[model samples]
Target: MSKLSEKASEYLSREERLNVLSTSNKAGENNIAVFGSVMAVDDSTVMLMLGENTTCANLRENPRAALLVYVPGKGGLQAEGCRVYLRLRAMEDTGERFEQIKAGIRARVGDAADMLKHLAIFEVLKVRPIIDLGQEI
Candidate 1:
């Protein structure tokens, strides 16, 4: 797995960053949801805590997902600056990784972690800037 860029890593570490997760269903219907329970695993993979919801159902049918991460400001989430969009393909399910990720989430999020029944592992396919307004953003 390759490591995430410095900028992306910084955004991932910030708790206030906004994340919008997108997926498509078996019938090619688009679905977007607010999913904040995500953690960067290594440099190329991410562990998204999911319940038995539409997002999970969509991913089960189609493992493709795109995560939009926005840098927070005094105003709020924006689309023009300091954003990293990631395209990912689902990885295979493994018992060891599932247990480890569950433990990790429990460690970080505590009791509420029980809601995370499944770990959706994704392989980073690509990362790109949303609007390159220059100035290292």
Candidate 2:
């Protein structure tokens, strides 16, 4: 496995623990929602599941997306200007990658296997990390 920077790894892990904001396309507009199970596959890639919703529909039409996540808890690291831009690729209904991701999800959220069995897996490509530090901490 490729290793990520300390800061990047910390940010990704923290984001995995919290709900992430996923932005997709709509009818000439933008649709954003909170997703509970966003995960990082590597320093430059993320994986998520999309169901039959406006977000999924929009992704089918326009695959570009942005994800935002922040740290949680008191005295947690403040993350405001951090974002990830992804060029959405293929959406998998079922495959080896899907099983791998599902296993990872099961590790995080127990008892979600059956419920998520029908969800579609999305593979994101060319993810670019954008972080802006407002002030020195």
Number of clashes recorded per candidate = 0, 0
What lDDT does candidate 1 reach at residue 111?
Answer: 85
lDDT of 2 by residue, 1-137 (tens): 12334454466666444545555564567788776656666665566765567777777777777666555543334333245566665677688877777777788778755455433333433232344544321
lDDT score, candidate 1, position 27:
98
Error of 1 at 92 (Å): 8.1
lDDT (CA) for every model shown? 0.69, 0.58
Give Cα distance to truth, residue 3, candidate 2, Å: 12
List, residue by residue over 22-95, the lDDT tens digit for candidate 1.
89988999999877777777678776778778888888788778787776564433453233334445533447
**Model 2 stretches astray by more than 4 angstroms:** 1-6, 74-81, 106-137
Each candidate's TM vs. the true structure?
0.73, 0.65
Candidate 1 TM-score to native: 0.73
What is residue 66's positional error in candidate 2, in angstroms?
Answer: 1.1
Clashing pairs in 2: none
